[model samples]
Target chain A: MRHPSYLLACLYLLSLSACTSVTIDEYQRAEASLASGDRIVLLGRRHSPDYETEPDLINCVGKVISANQSGISVIPEKQFVDELYPWFEPRMAPMRPERLEYLMKQPQVREKIEDLKLRYVIWIDGSTQQTGSAGSVGCAVGPGGGGCFGFGTWDDKSDYEAEVWDYQKQDLVAKVSADAKGTSYMPALVVPIPLLARVQSNACKGLGAQLREIFVPDSSANAGA
Target chain B: MKKQLSRSLLMLSSLILAACSSQLTVKGQFPSPLTTAMPLHGAAYYSPELISHSYAEDDEDRVKWNIQTGAAQQEFFDSLLPALFQQWAGHSPDPEGEAFKLPGVDIIVKPTLSDFQYSLPRETRSKIFEVWIKYNMQLYQNDGQLLADWFITAYGKTPSGFMQSDEAAMNEAIIVALRDLGANLTVNFSRVPELQDWMGKRDSSVQQQSADRGGVQNETP
Candidate 1:
């Protein structure tokens, strides 16, 4: 019965930690669809001075979308930026669909996009930040050995939004956003046991799944056909 | 045997201490800007010192750093100037010689690395390395009249990563700064007041010459 109390406490701690809630909201102005040969490029917005959207998050979403969806190709962000060169650099990239019209007017850029069969440009902006943190863990080492004893906990929030621009139509077709929040903990008696909440990855998967649903509504149906 | 062991320990300590210093050779890939080429022949002149520029700093804590960016700057302009003008030419003087004016060049551009500075993660109490570069750009006409003299400043920063070397982080920061320089120069070149005035006058003069030639042709019949 005494050991059962330890089990109950463990369950309580696990319940308090590692619980991530992800919410996704999508706005579509027009019908958005993707063809088999069409390509999509994911770019992170880096113009903000305070915080930059992490390249890792962009890559994670790209991987998730490509892994789950069929007949969809995702262009690597660096490749796309490098192929277009200075035009797509952080300061020079088009922030709005209207500015993209001017970019398309450039013959080389237009030709490259056409040659690559690029259909959509998804601009992901936002970052994950530590909203709050409390508690601390301490460890000691001596001639005999070393052990850690304490409890530490922190909260993180991630907010990201994706703006999908259609190349042919030269308009913003869809806007999707994801927000996630979670708390992580590390409890130590003799050894520290870490329970990390995957807030950024959860947000990435949520956003990726929503993007896939918009691009491919009936993936199974398409597959059977 | 004790003396030999002490010497070995001394050598190991020196090796560990030497690892704290960093030397970085910055390299970058510059892209041609996306703008219509102006109908002018521009000659770019880079001094030998600019081509071999390096910034070295020794801090109070005995940490030394040297960053070489001269070759990268030269390459950046070599790719940028040709795409900005209809005709492009490059001129470089020998180490001991002075750069002379080109015969048929419409405009000459001289750029110099004025200043370079950086900050380390430990100093800033943050997980990022930052670099700033300042350049002085001088534009002259074929007759040696100064058209525009301006300063362009660029900044770059990279977040420090776990298990990443200081040299790698600094190199990435330099590359970012170089890219930023390209973006600023390409987008803001035509907007310079002196350049705009000179270009407007040059275009009108060319139009006048064409009109005079047409009048002469009309009278010949």
Candidate 2:
């Protein structure tokens, strides 16, 4: 009974609204996989002179440990016996396939590790580049008592990027790379606040979740015991 | 009446735009750099020469002990040693607000200026500050027997125009290196096992609490 023009307008509105509903497939998969018992290990390394590997690895592992609620046991890959036991020797042994298999077959090792619901190994390698763009704008305000004066303000924008990788089945399963941008406005009368770092932090956290999903498929097959 | 309404609408729009355009600012004052002071000792020693290989030269350059003393070199040490000490002091877990006591019986900062070279390849490489600060610190007795001997290097690069800033840069580099060294020293002093055990217990408790609350049992102790 509605007019044709109204119907067309309604349809247009619906179509426009559809564009805003982002189907975040990555987040959904990560959440689903995490709900099921799946063990994941994070092996983080940095190939840059500026970065320290241990702290970043610890942070990434902390994120993984915090995200999942299942019986998932997130371990640092370096802590595995095959990696640590070599320290006792005069020289470290090379990571041979036979040695790996033997280590995997050990009863104590198998018993403690077999109960792991799922195993996910993630590697993060990236650098942080900080760049900013600034601009100024002027505004006029009428006097509250009589007339208004004018004020100038400055604004800035910052961007960040992260490079990540996931290894599964002893192969490179997936790779995730992301960038985030944010802006900060400083009034002429006030001090400037650094807002870009906050935006970048949020982006990195979101990327972490996305990386989890890409590396771990949301299927019973990948579920931990 | 229509004209008045239009004027009011325009004013409302202007108000909205003004409100949207304005920026929020915060003001705070940081502590003055000078208010905080670092403890100083009378004299520090250095090894004879720095040992480094130059990319341009085939041979390794090693300066002997007696050749490494001067006003310029002293200036370099003045900047470097304090920076290192400050870095250690910042992260030292000796409880905040207490005087910084050297962990060992005697604190000795033994600096070595190795690979000190000034060359001109493209432009004039007037002054290149490359040196290593090796702390041969002993906890007990002043006889140079060290409880901990931390070897750290501070590298500095200066352009012709910025040659004067070399001392400051060297100082900053030494501070960073010493901060790292101090962290290592603290870790070694505390012994990683005790810290690991504490961290493990904390992790276990956290996991247990999470399990009890039925929140998320994803973490393993």
Q: Which regions of candidate 1 deviate over 4 angstroms? A: A1-17, A135-150, A187-193, A218-225, B1-21, B58-64, B94-99, B120-126, B142-145, B210-221
lDDT of 2: 0.37
Question: For candidate 1, what is the DockQ?
Answer: 0.47
Query: How big a share of the true inter-chain contacts is recovered in candidate 1?
Result: 0.57
Residues A13-116, model 2: lDDT tens digits: 43431111111122122222344555565543422333323334346534643465424456655444223322111122212213434434444434544554
User: lDDT of each model, Cα atoms only?
Assistant: 0.84, 0.37
Give the runs in model 2 whose Cα sits over 4 Å from its true position.
Answer: A1-44, A50-65, A68-71, A76-120, A135-169, A188-197, A215-225, B1-221
